[model samples]
Target: MNAHDPIRRCILLGERAPRESLIRLALSPDGAVFPDVRAKAPGRGAWIGVTRAELESAIAKGKLKAALARAFKTGPIAIPDDLPDMIAAALERAVLDRLGLEARTGNLLTGAEKIEAAARSGKLHLLLHAADAGTDGNRKLDQAWRVGKDEEGSDLRGLALPVPRTILAVALGRQNVVHIGLTERDAARRVSETLTRWLHFIGSHPALPTCETVSQGASALQIIPTGAGNSVADDDTCEELE
Candidate 1:
């Protein structure tokens, strides 16, 4: 949608969508196929516009294999039986890698007190809770976020990440990271969009609204409005919890 967002046609759906919204699958020189979730892989690539379930359906019906053969103009590219699992794992790693990068860049704050203070000060763009975090703690933080935004009249946002505490702590290189706050809007968008895609891929519908809904202020998590031209492809990764 934006100047930098490229449009690619999905080989399966034949529909043109922003590159970020489609999944990229690349063929290596030796004819091996791998899911290029980051879209930075080398060699020729094909795009698919379907969700994970749809992709699985395509595989089940032999459509994906046939389509890939046609796209690559090859006879048969030994499609891995666990191709879906491979893509899922790669996406998960990409999400965790991005989180780690954010932590290293000091754009992320962990720990309840630090996150709460950031939220209270209206400096937090997003608040992320681990999936396995206690309901009491989650409620307390949600209340704090609401109170802080109410006081400042700011429309910040928060969500429960699909990742559990153990994965979050490991990703952040911390001991126990139950909660996290992102102070940067770009970082928050990246994290949220990636997580959303992952959840969709795994057939898990999150309770939160889509980014557009959040940006429109139609949801409880008042996200800062990103311009209309931004597309889902702007978020570079995807995955679900184990």
Candidate 2:
């Protein structure tokens, strides 16, 4: 409920946001930082990050404008489409960071190694897998479940500094990380939210696919067209972003 969440602020400030300590608001969600959620323009700033459904609900009920009005310390800044992409991106980065760390520290176990290691370990505080993994691998996990980035660090392996997509971006001295496990401290909690993002699209499977870009499953990944329609919510050509 806290409006000034750092990640949400990052969404507001986009690239213009300072990465370090506390800073003031940026232009808007539809600014250069991201081309989505164009409604938050030219007006003052307010932060709100709970859940996409919740935000959408607020919009449906008109509570969104009321809250923004009070928070902006004035009348509400015009909130365009309640595009939660900024929040979604933040969550996605969180997942990538976790996957990256598991790759870096040797904790992330992909392929058969993930299942073999988990089986050998017995009961786990948390379980994880991509939403898109095959049914064959899915059957292998005793209690394998989908994990979100928010759940990465705490319930699963303890990681420090969260997951970094760079680890995944670079070849493991060879190929980028398709799968990994986090067994190190500091890195565990950092990657929870990130993992949650992955679980959103890829379901939780016991073993990581032998390859990246796993096959899709029953998960509600494309619940809506991302980015494509945000700028044009009410048939308006997203003036804020342009």
Candidate 3:
């Protein structure tokens, strides 16, 4: 992170972190709390860096209400019982929307052949797989990425998204988007930022396949080297075929 990167404090966690890394909760005129994943809502907002389970627990114990009441300076803050789910859904949408934008710009590559070529050429900045993509397919592409990066013996691999191929296809307006390779550095950074926040918020959802979990295969995608000019990776434009 740059020395001038904006920072915010998480109300529940009481820890300072990069503003974009935390989830923002915007308040309606009636003091209803809503997810502001894009951070574009024009109003006072509170931030939280807790996971879904932690948020749910806070709500059950009335901690979140108290925190919001304090943050919004209101006696009664309206928090929906489904606030955690709402946040998760909003974050998920943000990730998919980003991928769509990147896809439209032609900054990414799909299809096993194309991705593998980019990976082998060391031009692939970020690699990702649909949750339901075949394991053998993912491994093949991951090995190509590692080989390109010259980390042949390492565990570097593509991320297995929490959503399946059907959802990915709809998001990118393509069919059977089993894997993706972002070729632009900026594009990779942007996508990685969005994906990181979503994964951090959701923690370990069951939809993520164990074999492709970040801890298992894609840990290298979590943080880009500071010298690489970004703290995370994933953004770019790409037109997907098939």
Candidate 4:
């Protein structure tokens, strides 16, 4: 979504809310995802992340109940026992498991410097910009976008890197990339699924624009070292294709 554009505040809530039975919250905001730890019961939802502390804070402050009532413009409903933690853990595990799978498949790129190079190459179908990474890191890497050459072979610089917090970086990745990029068709599909969960569990945020391709050193990708596969230093981009 455009940064300045009004974010579509729709929620992608779960089929079952994290609350007592009969209580339900919808996750659609305007168009995409939203976290709703608070107000996740018996009414409309207030978006929240998949963090345990946030859930606890909501419970302690009564924010969870109040928000639900506020969203519904009604009275408060009871919060379920440990529902917040359960929800957060569930979300966290699901996110990490997916990332691990992608990592194993040679689809995912972790580590900042590694992806930074990828960002520069314009080879990225998606740049998994970390939600927690500072504005500067986000900006610098986002700068890697070189607009695609137009029909006249003139550089338009029109193309910007698509940075979707659109995807999630998780507590599991350990640092914070809950962020992920996608290039291949299958990987992109997994990215989409991950994106849906992010939207459903995490609230809306401004995502960066997308870039085209990143040129690598070799005409073909060579053998890449593990643990560095997600590294910007890895020179295996076209090698796999070759």
TM-score of each: 0.80, 0.45, 0.84, 0.40
Q: Which segments of candidate 1 are over 4 A away from where they belong?
A: 151-157, 207-242
Task: State candidate 1's TM-score.
Answer: 0.80
Q: Name the lDDT of candidate 3.
A: 0.75
- Tens digit per residue, CA lDDT, model 1, 4-49: 5555556777655555555788777677778988888755578776
Point out where model 2 deviates above 4 Å.
1-49, 74-76, 122-126, 143-179, 193-242
lDDT of 1: 0.68
RMSD, model 2, all Cα superposed? Answer: 13.4
Cα lDDT listed for each candidate: 0.68, 0.36, 0.75, 0.40
Q: What is the lDDT of residue 8 in candidate 3?
A: 62
| Candidate closer to the true structure by TM-score (higher is better), 2 or 4 | 2
Tens digits of per-residue lDDT, candidate 4, 69-146, equal 544443435566666555645554555566567766777775657665664564545555554456666554445533
Q: Top model by lDDT, which number?
A: 3
| Candidate 3 accuracy as TM-score | 0.84
